[model samples]
Target: MAKEIKKVVLAYSGGLDTSIIIPWLKENYNNCEVIAVSGDVGQGTELDGLEEKAIKTGASKLYIEDLKQEYIENYIWPCLKADAKYEDYLLGTSHARPCIAKRLVEIAKAEGADAICHGCTGKGNDQVRFELAIKAFAPDMKIIAPWREWSIKSRDEEIDYAEAHNIPLKINRETNYSKDKNIWHLSHEGLDLENPANEPQYNKPGFLELGVSPEQAPDEPTYVTIHFEKGIPTAVDGEELGAVELVTKLNKLGGANGIGLLDIVENRLVGMKSRGVYETPAGTILYKAHNVLETITLDKETFHYMQSQIAPKMADLTYNGQWFTPLREAIGAFVDKVNENVTGDVKLKLYKGNVINAGVTSPYTLYDEEIATFDEDEVYDQKDSAGFINLFGLPIKVQAKLKAKNSAE
Candidate 1:
C-alpha cells in the first residue's frame, strides 16, 4: 500500500528525466497536484518555454526562481577562495545541486506540499546532494525519488514510457547524453562517456558545449587580466563588472581560447567511480587567476596550509553534499581570513588548454625582489643562514656523533 500523497513539489528542469516525471507522478500518486520548481541558476535560454511545457505536461504551476546570485556568491565563491577542486575535477554539478535543492525545499514549504521529488537517478551523486539539502532545510518532508521506486530501469524504458504517454521528447537514443548546465559549467555524462576507454569526440559537432577542444583553438593566444577584491573576481580587462557579468565575460573569453575542458574519472559519494566531461570556462579562468594572485598576497605558511589542508577537505565536503554543515562554514571563516589581503590583478595567456600566468600584482605582496635576490643584497644576510642550517640539522649531527662514539668504544 502506497502512502497517500496529495501534492508534491518537484525540482524540475525541462530535461528528459524531469519531463517524464510529471506524468509518472500523476499516474502513481493518485493524480496528485504537481508543483514544478526550477531554480534559474544561470541556465539562460534553457528557461524559455519551460512554464508552457510544464503546464502542457500536467503540472499545476511552475515556479522559476532566479538563484544565479546566490549560486555564484554563496556556493562558487567560497569554493574558489578555498581553492577546492575534487581530484583535479572542477565541482560544477556537485555544488549546483544544493543551490537548486535549497530553492526546491523553500517552494515545497510555501506551497504546502506533502512530499518533494527529484529526477536524479539512483546511481548518481545528485540524489545525495538534493536529499541532504532537503533534510537540512525541511527535515520532515518526505522525499519521493522516482528512480528508486519506479519500475523504469533504463533510459530505453523511460523513452518507451514517454512515447506511450504521448510526451514529446527532444532527445532520442542516438543524440542522448545526460547533461547539466549552469552559468559556471556544463557537464556531460552517460552514452559513450560511460566507458573510460573511449576518448571524448571533442571535434564532433554538438559534443562540446561551453568551449572548443585544444585542436580547434586559434593560433594566436588570448590574454586576460582578472581583477580580484578579497578573492572575488570584480573585473576583466580593466572593466569592473558585477559577479554575474564577470563570470559571463570570462566564459566567452576563456571558451574562445579553448580553456576549461576537463575529463576525469572521479570517485562519487555512492562508492563508485564515474567518468564525465566537464566544460567550465569561467570557473577555470577564475581559479587560475586567483591562484596567481594568492602566490603574492598570502604568506608561505598560510598559502601552504590552505593548499594542503583546507583545499582537499573543502573539495570532499562540497562533493559529499555537506555544504550547509558547520565545519564547512567554519572552514569558510578561515578561508575568508586568509583572503583578506588577496586583492590583486592576474594576467594570463590562454592558448590551447593552458592558462599561463602572464603577470601578477598585489597591493599586499610578500614577494620582495630584494630579499629573494641571489646577488649581494643588504636586505638579507646570506652568511647568517649557516647558523640556522647548523641548528636545524643538530639532531642529525648528534645522532652521527653518538654512532661514531659507540663504534670507537
Candidate 2:
C-alpha cells in the first residue's frame, strides 16, 4: 500500500527525466500536489522558463534558487583547498548534488510538504548523494525516488511518456545525452559515450559544448596568473574578483585554450563502472594554480600528506555524499589549518590542454634560493653534507656489513 502523501516537493531539472516527473508524481500519488524545485548553479540559460514550464506540467508552483555562490564557496572551495579529485573527474556534479539537496529539504519543510521526491535513478551515484543529504537535513521527511519505483526503464521511454502526456521535452531519442552542468563544470554521458571503445566525436558540431577539442585549439599558448589568499582563489592576474567572476574569467581563457577536458571510465559508488566526459575549464585551471602555489608555500610534510594521504580520502567522501558527516568536517578543519599559510600567486601557460607552470611567488614561500642554488653561497651547506649523508646511510651500511659477515662465515 502507498503511504499517505498529500503533497510532495520534487527536485526538478528542466531535463527529459525531470520534465515528465512533475506530472508523474501527481498521477501516481492520487493527484498529490508537486512543488518543483530547481537550483541555478551557473548552468547559464538552463533556468530559463523553468517556472512557466513547471506550472504548465501540472506543478502547483516552482522555485528556482540561485545556489552558485554558496556552492562555490562551500563545496568547490573545500575540495580545491584540499586538492581533492576522484579518478579523472573533478567532482563537479558530486559537489552540486548536496547543495541542491539541502535546498530541496529546506523547501520541503517550508512548504510543509508530506514527502520529498527526486529525479535521480536508483543505479546512479546521485541517488546516494541526494538521499544522503536529504536524510541529513530531514531525517523524518519521507523521500521518493521516481526512477527507482517508476516503470520507465530508459531515457527513450521517458521521451515516449512525455509525448503521451503531451509534455514537451528538450531532447529527443537521437540527441539524448545525459548531461549535468553547473558553474564548476559540464558533464556528458550516455549515447556513444557509453561505449568506451568509441572515441568522443568532439568535432561533431554539438558534441563538445564548453570549448573546442585540443586538436582544434590555437597554436599559440595563453598565459594566466592566479592569486590565492590563504588557499582561496581571489584574483585572476592582477584583477580582484569574486569567486563567480574569477571562475568565469578563467573559464573563458581556459576554454579557449582547450583546457580541462577529460574522458574517464570511473568506478561509481554503486559498485559499477561508468563512462563520462567532463569539461571543467575553470576548475582545472584553479586546481592547477593551487597545486603550483602549494609547492612553494606549503611545508614538505603538509604538502605531501595533504595531496598523498588526505586528498583521496576527501575525494571519496565528497564523491560518496558523506559531506555532512563529522569525519568530513574534521578533515576539512585539518585542511583549513594547513591552508592557513598557503597564500601565493602562480603563473601558468595554458596550451593545447596542458597547464605548464611559468612561475610561483609567495611571501611565505619555503623555497630559499640561497640554500638551494648550485653556485657558492654563504649558507654553508656544502661541508655539512658528508656527516648528514653518513648518518642517513647508517642503516644501509650496517645491513651491508652484516650480509658480508654472513657470507664470509
Candidate 3:
C-alpha cells in the first residue's frame, strides 16, 4: 500500500510521458494537487507554453527553472575534466539527469510537498537516477513513478488515455522516435532504433535535429581554436564566452561539419542492453581538444594513469547516476588537481565527420624541444642510453641466459 499524499511535485518536461502523468497522479493519489517543475538545461523552445499546458492538464502551478548555466558549470564541466565517456558515449544525457533531479527536490521542499513524481519508465535507468537523487536530498519524501505503478503498458495505450481525458500531446502514435535534447547533446531512441540491425537514416528529414549528414556537410573544412582554463572550455575562436555560450557555439560549428553522430548499443544500469543514436556536437569537439591539451600539459605518468584508470571509473560513476556519492566527489577533487595545469589552447580542423587536431600549446607544457631534438644537445648525452638500456634489459638478459643453460643441459 502507498502512503497518503496531499501534494506532489512532478519533474515535468511537457513530453508525452510527463504530460499524461499529471492527470494520472491526480486520479491515483486521491485528487492530490500536482505542481509541475521543469528544469531548463538549454532545451530551447521546448519549454514554450509549458505553463499553459501543465495547468490545462491538471497541475496547479508550473515552475520552469533556468538551470542551463548551473548545469554546465557544476555537472558538465566536472565530467569533462574527469574525461568521462561511457563506452563511446559522451555521457550527455547521463550527466544531465542528476542536475534536473536535484532541482526537482529543491522545488518540492520549497512547496512543502510530501511527494515527488517523475515520468521515467520502470525499464529504464532514469528511474533509478531520479529516485536515488531524491532520496539523497530528501530521504523521507515519497516517490511516485507512474510507469511502475500504473496499468498503462505502452505508449499507444498512454495516447489512448490522453485522448479519453482530453490531454494535449505533441507526440502521437505515429511518432517515429523518442528524443531528449539539451544544450550539450540530443539523444534518439525507440522506433527503428530498437532494432540494431537497421542503419540510421540520417539523410531522412526530421531524423536529425542538431546536425546534417557528413555527406551534406560543407565541402571546405572549418577551423576553430578552443581555449581552456583548468580543463574547462572558456572560449572559441579567441572570443571569450561563458560555459553555456561556449557549448552552444561549438554545437553549431561542429554540427555544420557533421562532427558528432554515434550509433551505439550500450549496457544500461538496469542490466539491459539498449541502442541509442546520440548527437553530441560540442561535447565531441571539447573532449578531443581537452585531451590534446592534456597530452602537452600533464606529465607522462599522470596522463597514462588517468587514461587507464581514473577516466573509466569516472565514466562508470557518472553513467550509473552516482553523482551524489562521496566517491565521485573525491575523484572529482583529484581530477581538479590534475586539471590545474590543463590551461591551454587547442586548434582543431572540423571536416566531414572528423575533428582533427591541428595544433596545441600551453604555458605549462612539459615538452622540451631542445632535449627532444634529434641533433646532439647539451641537455642529453648519447652514451647515457647505453648504460640505461643495459640496466633496463638486465632481467631479460638474465632470464634468456638461464633458459639457454637449461636447454643445453
Local accuracy by lDDT, each model: 0.92, 0.91, 0.92
Sorted by lDDT (best first), the order is: 3, 1, 2
- Write one digit per residue (lDDT tens) for candidate 1, span 1-409: 2457999999999888998999999989999999999999988888899999999999999999998889999999999999999998778888898999998988888899999999999899899999999999999999999999899999989999888888878789898898889999998889999999999999998888788898999999999899999999898899999888888888888888889999999898999999989999899989999999999998889999999999999999999999989999999999999999999899999999899999999989999998988788887877899999999999999999999999999
Mark the 10 consecutive residues where model 2 has the least summed lDDT: 1-10
Question: Which one wins by TM-score: 1 or 2?
Answer: 2
Judged by whole-model lDDT over C-alpha atoms, candidate 1 comes out at 0.92
- Decreasing TM-score order of the candidates: 2, 3, 1
TM-score of each: 0.97, 0.98, 0.98
Candidate 3 lDDT tens digits, 221-306 = 99999999999999899999999889999999999899899999999999999999999999999999999999999999999989
For 1-409, candidate 2 gives per-residue lDDT tens digits of 2449889998988888889998888888988989999988998988888888999999999998999899999999999999999996899999899999999999999999999988888889999999999999999999988998899998888988999999877777899999998888999999999999999888889887788888888999999999999899999889999999988898888888889999999999999999999999999999999999899888889889998988999999999999989999999999999999899889999999888999999999999999889898998768799999999999999999999999999
Candidate 2, backbone clash total? 0
